[model samples]
Target: MSRVSDTEPCGTETAVRSTRPKDLTSRSSFGVLGTLYSAGEQGLALDAHRSLSRSTLLRLRDRRTGAFIEEFTAWADGFGEYRVRLTARARRHYAHHHACYRELYPDIDTPVPRPTDGAHGGLVDHRADRDPARNLLREADVLVLDALIRLQGGEIGRLQKPPIGRYQRGTSPEIGAMPPGLLYREAEKLANSRKPISRLLQHPDGPLVAVVEVTSLLPWAATGSIPLPALIVLTTRGRDHYESHLDSYRRAYPDLDLQLSRHTM
Candidate 1:
């Protein structure tokens, strides 16, 4: 990928016009698939931590002894196959990891009355009314999103369960059939919806935001450096899924402009 010019700072209207035809899908929150080890068992989970410092990354790897991947990948075959299945796995991961973030923004009172800094636990909770982290996340979900997209090919480097085995003779013939493209689509949807729903939950009365993913159709808009628009409409299978939603949101709130990011399928 070519670097943007130093003279032209990213996120300019002039730059937008000069760039290729815009994609409308924009995503705020990025969901990452990871493996965690507990006891002898391993599990798959989603992580909100944006980037791990080199030290933290090394520490996590050292602690696990390559066990995290084996446990998580073995949890199920569906995880690597479909985006929806991955979503389910991520939800489970979030619930489990909630404790880590919760420590920073403990709902329960402690002797220290741990400060409610948004960085630790603020982004995940939708019900907190005074969470600046929530607002910041709503504004910067794209940051999380872009990082995850760039990591598509080799982000999670760890041991994992073996690939799905061949079907048994007694099972139905179609039992193991699943299209590869389907996983990409679902991954796109999950990635796209992350920030929007987080926004809705965090700021029930605030403006609407669009979330999207990078795919083949909207290559022009996939540049990770750009600040995403208000409305995002990613392209897959040569059609835009978010078109009607965008139109409906526009009709309801014209003041909030639409932003798009297209990824060709």
Candidate 2:
């Protein structure tokens, strides 16, 4: 990992960011599955397909040519051929949908949520570090897993998003970071506060891929001024699972802090 000045946002070490184009062109349609993301609102145990089907306005593409046969009619103007109906979901993905973010639905310009921040570094969660409680860790795991699927768009089966309420205050001293939320009021209201999982990208019919966070690198609260830790990730499928296709995830998500887990298989 390269050294980033500790002054700006703290997630760029492995953050997933969008290099938004000045204007949309035909080539913009190339990103199909990864064009969207979502924070699992229903948990990775529900049928998300049913929710996606509700959207009347949809976008389709030519498989061979990778062109947008159906373009966005609403939501965003130049986000490629991504469907317009569930644009709120896509927005959620970019709007601090990762972890420990309290910001709600945010626009495309909103800054990516960070696990740790400037000099204080205390603005982070050590839950995944000091205390790996089964319940809380599992919840975090489910969220990370669903996020992986949303950003990676593999054959993972429909996962119901976990409710945000599941977030509990951890006894771990290091586990004192911000909560997940959105920046804008309108976008926050539109987010899945009522619904589960804000955004999704999947086949109309596909088998759920059983996966979740097996291990993850939680930036520890500053240990007497030590800087934030480099973002790391490990999943149920092991490290190679992501190592092989990491670039794809980065394309959709810029500050994505994932490495790969060496367990689950």
lDDT of 2 by residue, 130-165 (tens): 233321212222334334434343322111112212
Q: Mark the regions of model 2 whose C-alpha exceeds 4 Å error after superposition.
A: 1-143, 146-205, 209-244, 263-265
Residues 132-168, candidate 1: write the lDDT tens digits: 2322333233322332333332333111112322212
Q: Quote each prediction's TM-score.
A: 0.20, 0.19
**135 in model 1: Cα distance from truth in Å?**
2.5
| Candidate with maximal TM-score | 1
Model 1 Cα shift for residue 26 (angstroms)? 30
Query: Alpha-carbon error at 229 in model 2, in Å?
Result: 33
Top-lDDT structure, candidate number: 1
